[model samples]
Target: MKFLFLITFIHILPQCSGNPLSRHHTTSEEIKREIARYSDIAKAIINLAVYGNAQNRSYERLARFVDTIGPRLSGSKNLEMAIKYIFNALQEDGLENVHLEPVKVPHWERGVESAMMLAPRSYNISILGLGSSVATPPEGITAEVLVVTSFDELHKRAQDAKGKIVVYNQPYISYEETVKYRLLGAVEAGKVGAVASLIRSVTSFSINSPHTGLQKYQFDVPKIPTACISVEDAEMMARVASRGTKIVVTLKMGAKTYPDATSFNTVAEIVGSKYPEQVVLVSGHLDSWDVGQGAMDDGGGAFISWEALSLIKELGLRPKRTLRLVLWTAEEQGGVGAQQYYQLHKVNISNYDIVMESDEGTFTPMGLAFTGSDKARAILKEIMQLLQPINVTNIYENGGGTDIDFWVRDGVPGASLYDDISKYFWFHHSQGDTMTVQDPSQMNLCAAVWTVISYVIADMEERLPR
Candidate 1:
């Protein structure tokens, strides 16, 4: 870490006295002109990723990866294989400093699970046990159902919730808002004395598909069987309850949590030509829930990050600062791998010029969501102008990286790719997140956006103001 800062110092010393990157000495005009000078570099990156040999490369790579590795849940053998696969690919690609960082991650398995409606006419319900959920007894939990729309409503009728299975049929306002139920439904249900919880899938549109995600068990409350049911099943129970009909359901699950398993974050980089210690980071998570192929959730994001480095390497463009690609593990389990990486790397946080992530689906490219000082934003906006050929230059404020959030919160500039995610939640965390949902042309556009922005920033005259 000291070497990184020393390299930056040595590289900047000769030009430091009149350095154009000085926020205090340099005016906005200088920043704009300096950023404008990179237009040619950006255009080259865009052309190569979108129209040249690299076009559609990310899509093909992702398809092949997901088809082979399949779903890679945290602490699972599949995830380990996926990590080894990526490590080998990085080494084969001849990327610099390809290595792995070990971290302990939670290992939770979803064993055979089933739910059946026993009252108000027998019916079978499609269900997915939430991550880390406790299993129902061998005989299963059979009881009347208490349907509620929101936490407030559940609390209002807490007395009736006792000794029943609570079904949350909350409307899908948005993933950010609706996901709370999936994350906390079990705890709330347990608090109200419910034996089990059946949360409505956190999706806007579902065709009898149930989405599963990580949920927490509050040690203060008793652990109960928790799972997500299809939107159709949830609504049907609500309608039946509204009609004054009693609903009884039997829930059985064999889910279990074992001791933490060792996992690794796959890492590779393009070493800098000048300031090898200074770094610009790009990333995506490699692990996903054990559903579908996990392609849409993060396979698209991860491959595109790798593609960015590949594009720059093929173009013979060498940035002054190291451009590192980190394929995070256990991101689905609340960024466990990233948290550990942060702990190991934050000591040299000053050397991190910028951090970029692309966890959201790599659909059609829009622009970028940035988190940094106004001066940095101004520089980035001009830098983005180089992408006019592809028309993905807009910058929003709400988008940043989950894995890189720690660094951003600690005052480093951060970036996340902004794209069309109108239908992202529809397949998120569900069995529908397969490779079939990916489009080659769209992946090409997204890779273009990611490559241009990341390459330009790394090779810029000065790092963005922090």
Candidate 2:
């Protein structure tokens, strides 16, 4: 099935005649003509970072910081440390007006958590409470387990759920679909008065560590203790319950919410020489889940954006329009940081030429996805041709990332660097998502592509007519 989809996509590639791969040689006069006519600043930025040694050093430095600092859960002390680390790094990069904009963020702490079966057979289970989950009572909630795979199923049999712990046994097929269960399962289960809810970890791969993410509570529903069990354990429980054997689960969690804390979004810019009033923004969320250092989830994205801007400055390349880098805060809990930024700076959005975000994990560059008018698309296509040498040739529509959607909705053109996502979902919210899991070489390639895109947009004579 995957092969068929690949073949179909390849066949349709010809419909987009501007694809750089359709042409043979990079040095060909025709290719050179395209490069010269279209500003290749973005591509140059990418090339210098990917192929040059300076960018490699930057990656090494940032990776070291991420590993040593560990997980950066939003509103946590580690997140505060990460913010300072990035702010200092940007200051040293010759960026102007490097500062943090204050943002109010929720503080949720994940303390000790454990779950086990005390039923037909005794066995301990691996689990982690989702962010923002209410703690189980001190004695813990021990009740017979009722498992259902979807909300519809739970709704149909909610009457049978009283005085029982509900286990959401759904399997996430993709990131987009799986995320729904991870984010909403608790609330759905809570609505029916389930003593507690255990959701199957939302990852394609099975491992001992349970995945964790944010969950929402309905206004009227009593908040219930919710946690995610490892996929392996979830399957084991499902098998035992299918045999008509009674299954009792004991869940203990120390999760709690404290008073809202103040955090900040770090911002830095390189003022444009000719069109300083016009702005081109590139960003990534600085905050991450309190697991595994968040290296692959977003540390790579934040570092890549910083490195891209630093490269342009080092090369003495001053863009035509101001280039801004935003290291956003509180992206994990909700898009609170991004929303606050838009509200605080809505006036600036009109001058914003384009916005790009790289929240996707660092992997080999595939191409770019954009959301803009036809004229803007045409302009980007012209610039994308220069990136063909680095195997980043694919370009598609729908270019917004989760954090950048605000800008796109406000009419600023948005783009997201595309990467091979075949393995992205496996470790997405799992504890396995550490810096060691990332490919340094591929991350460097991403940095190259992002630098090129930022440079092109910043150097364009106008706003690409979007």
Best by lDDT: 1
Q: By how many angstroms RMSD does model 1 differ from the true structure?
A: 5.4
Clashing pairs in 2: 42-452, 46-448
Over 4 Å off, model 2: 1-47
| lDDT score, candidate 2, position 181 | 80
lDDT of 1 by residue, 244-284 (tens): 99999999999999999999989999998877888899999
Clashing pairs in 1: none
For model 1, the stretches where C-alpha displacement exceeds 4 angstroms are 1-24
Q: Which of the numbered candidates is closest to the native, going by highest TM-score? A: 1
Candidate 2 lDDT over residue span 1-466, tens digit each: 0111111111111213432222332222333354465445655566677776565755586678787788888779998998888888788877988999999999999898888789877889888789899998888889999888888999898987877889888877776787788788878878887888888988878767788888888788888898888888888778887888889988899998998899999999999888787788888888888877788778888888887788888778888888999988998887788889988888866678888888887788887888876656655666676677786756687899878898898778898878887887677777788877787778788887788777877775445444
- The deviation in Å at residue 306 for candidate 2 is 0.6
